[model samples]
Target: MANAASGMAVHDDCKLKFLELKAKRTYRFIVFKIEEKQKQVIVEKLGEPTKSYEDFTASLPADECRYAVYDFDFVTEENCQKSRIFSLPGLPTLQE
Candidate 1:
């Protein structure tokens, strides 16, 4: 697959890993910024039944969703981690 921004070739293994990660809900740190907000909010994934990047991207409000997926290329191997997905403050959980 190609890098969405640079149009450079991304390794097939990397692409497959990305898809696998998405399927496993292993990617955390979904960051976003609201209007006039200088700092980005990083939403850590909480638990199983984790939302896929595609589902999250499609469900986000148009006004706030700038990035569809977090760029893992910038993350170091040591920093790769997972978290339980939680409902943001004031938001209802899927069970609700």
Candidate 2:
């Protein structure tokens, strides 16, 4: 998501990515909340590092089969950027 990308943005990585939590497991995260109200994020890739935040629905798209459940430890965006999400052994190396 733009929030995730910009909030914890790396100077050279792609704005959006399908991250692998484990082998045969990939997921994506869009901005679910921001401050007082629900918001979505917008990133101007070519123009700036990232900018703009907007609103999004409170509900996730379970009907679309586009999501999965995983427990994540909430951390500041800065902390998230510096940490590795999963270990090397659990990384997605083979595309299935």
Candidate 3:
């Protein structure tokens, strides 16, 4: 199989292990919570050197509701930067 990060060959059992490794290493993640009634979305940065995922996840309503979790590392830093500027739904394109 292919590694989620580097796309190199990796065993199937290694996927969770790889995620655990990345979790320990610290990554920048954006956690968003939508308040449809108010038509507002709250965004916050979480992960080491600042906040933790547990804290971010806890901020959301425990009741079942629409939500999204995006892995930031899948996108290039350039795309991530553009996303910050435009607030697009997904990662931003270099041209935009």
Q: Which residue pairs clash within candidate 2?
A: 39-55, 40-54
Cα misplacement distance, residue 60 of candidate 1 (Å): 2.0
Cα miss at 68, model 1 (Å)?
A: 4.3
Candidate 3: lDDT of 31?
40
Which candidate number has the best TM-score? 3
* Deviation of model 3 at 77, angstroms: 20
Model 3 lDDT tens row, 1-96? 332233333333233332432455343344444444544433333334244446546655577452333333335756653212112244221112
TM-score each candidate.
Answer: 0.25, 0.19, 0.27
In order, candidate lDDTs are 0.37, 0.26, 0.37
Give the lDDT ranking, best first.
Answer: 1, 3, 2
Sort by TM-score, top down from the best: 3, 1, 2
Winner of 2 and 3 under lDDT: 3
Superposing all C-alpha atoms, what RMSD in Å does each candidate have to the true structure? 15.4, 14.9, 16.7
- Point out the worst 10-residue segment of candidate 2 by lDDT: 43-52
lDDT of 3: 0.37
lDDT per residue as tens, model 1, 1-96: 333233333333433433444566555423322222423223323222344556555556667443224423234578966443333332221112
Query: On TM-score, who's better, 1 or 2?
Result: 1
